[model samples]
Target chain A: DQQVKQNSPSLSVQEGRISILNCDYTNSMFDYFLWYKKYPAEGPTFLISISSIKDKNEDGRFTVFLNKSAKHLSLHIVPSQPGDSAVYFCAASAFIQGAQKLVFGQGTRLTINP
Target chain B: AAGVIQSPRHLIKEKRETATLKCYPIPRHDTVYWYQQGPGQDPQFLISFYEKMQSDKGSIPDRFSAQQFSDYHSELNMSSLELGDSALYFCASSLAAGRETQYFGPGTRLLVL
Candidate 1:
């Protein structure tokens, strides 16, 4: 079973526009959500994260909003740059058997058009 | 800014062979995680270690085993590899076990023919 899901496989936005990526989860035990950006042949790089207590968290041009009730979260990037184009993955964290492991979504490929 | 290191960026083996993948965590990090990303699929958790001990278990197969050394580096050993076992294996590390930011390595691409 896929605990976390990213419905959209890809998204494209023009430069200086806003890019929004959405993710959903079925497990209620997850209390932390994170976003990671990945380039081809490389590992994922951490972007932003939000705890269950907070509805939103922002750092610079990146903002992540979480809605526990909906079991959903989103990453928003304002004024998108071409450099931001990459595969974005959404992951949820939960403790299982005394260790915390991240469950990841399929990932969405985001492209920024110049 | 140190990062996780994975050796043998790419490995190709015949079916029924064995493979060993290694990971070196960043300085001062004590927890290590292993994940497998199959073709066109999201990463799936395999196993994790904390302080040189097995801490968490995921979807790891019986043919696979892992261990963390005293220096906090980890290794995943796979035996009797099958064609379906081909995938990109990633190793990540964090300061501790729970709720800490994980730093990932470039990943080792293993192909079983």
Candidate 2:
């Protein structure tokens, strides 16, 4: 029943500073929200996305914030670098039947220490 | 820039052996999704398809099965296999009219014994 929740499994930043990652959801009919960036074995890459009437969305250094009455969502990666570490997933987009489905979160292993 | 393609990346079977995972989308994409990550958990959607048919379904099981052809490529036929079905099998692609971005496929590390 983990309807998306990234309770911070791990996070350690420093490289250039600024690196936040958090996510929570319980299905509010999820409208769309994404952020992926895996590395180890690779597979997830697309990063940044938000829509549920939007709260914030940026693309240069990566940024995504959505509140939607606190269902929570966040992913900021300012100066941070070092390939920006890895493992950071927070996805939510539902539209059953007609397809479109993604609900993941249980990843947050960013570690960029220079 | 092309993405989403998976194959034998890795595999090993035994108990009740039977596995066949493949996916190749992203070239006119049409939608296809399948996920399963288990060691430490997180990714878990189990089925999806669009242009070829079978639209949605998750937590798949029942010996597992999937399809989506017509040159779109998709397959995931696991049978009997167990040992928690060793994990890590992802394949994602989107274009059901840009179904909100989805492109992944660098996984297929199954191991059952």
Candidate 3:
């Protein structure tokens, strides 16, 4: 049972353009959401995260939008750079037992073409 | 700028062999999590520890066991390894227990021959 889903397996965009990746979740119990960027052979790096109470969160060049009613979230990168090309994973956090575990999506490979 | 640390970046073992992987959480982090990622697959949660105790369990197999030490370092021990056990093992640490962001280690790649 995949509680988190990223329907798009891959995305491509030209450098200096905007790139948007979407994610959906089936579990409403998730109280927090995060997006992680990973490169080949390396661990995923923390990108950005939003609380379930918030609708939007933004960092320098990255923004995350959450739609609680739809159980959907999206990450947008403005003026994409070549370094932005990597696998993006959407993860949801839910409290279980005494700890919180992350449910990760299949991931979408974002390719920024230079 | 401390990150989670994992030892034995790569391990090659034969079937029925035993192996142990170690992880050191970032300073002041109180929770540790284990995840397994196979080729072309998303990471799967295995287990988690909080304050030197097992707090949660997931899809971990019976042949696997883990423990968190007083120093906050953790170890995952696998016995009677199988071919299907080959994968990248990631250790993540969080500041607290619930609703916290986890910082992951570089991961240990295990190959069962």
Cα misplacement distance, residue A25 of candidate 2 (Å): 19
User: In terms of docking quality, how is candidate 1 classified?
Assistant: high
Q: What is the TM-score of chain B in candidate 3?
A: 0.99
Decoy 3 TM-score against native: 0.99
- Best-performing candidate as measured by TM-score: 3
lDDT of 2 by residue, B50-70 (tens): 888888888899899999999
Q: Residue-wise lDDT of candidate 1 within B1-113, one digit each (tens)?
A: 88999998999999999999999999999999999999889999999999999999889999999999998999999999999999999999998888888889999999999
Candidate 2 RMSD to the real structure: 14.2
Q: Which regions of candidate 1 deviate over 4 angstroms?
A: none
User: Each candidate's interface RMSD, rounded to one decimal?
Assistant: 0.7, 9.1, 0.7
Candidate 3 regions with alpha-carbon error over 4 angstroms:
none
The superposed Cα distance between candidate 2 and the true structure at residue B71, in angstroms, equals 43
All candidates: TM-score: 0.98, 0.35, 0.99
Clashing pairs in 3: none
| Chain A TM-score values for every predicted structure, listed in order | 0.98, 0.34, 0.98
Put down candidate 3 lDDT per residue, B6-88, tens digits, no spaces: 99999999999999999999999989999999998999999999999999999999999999999999999999999999999
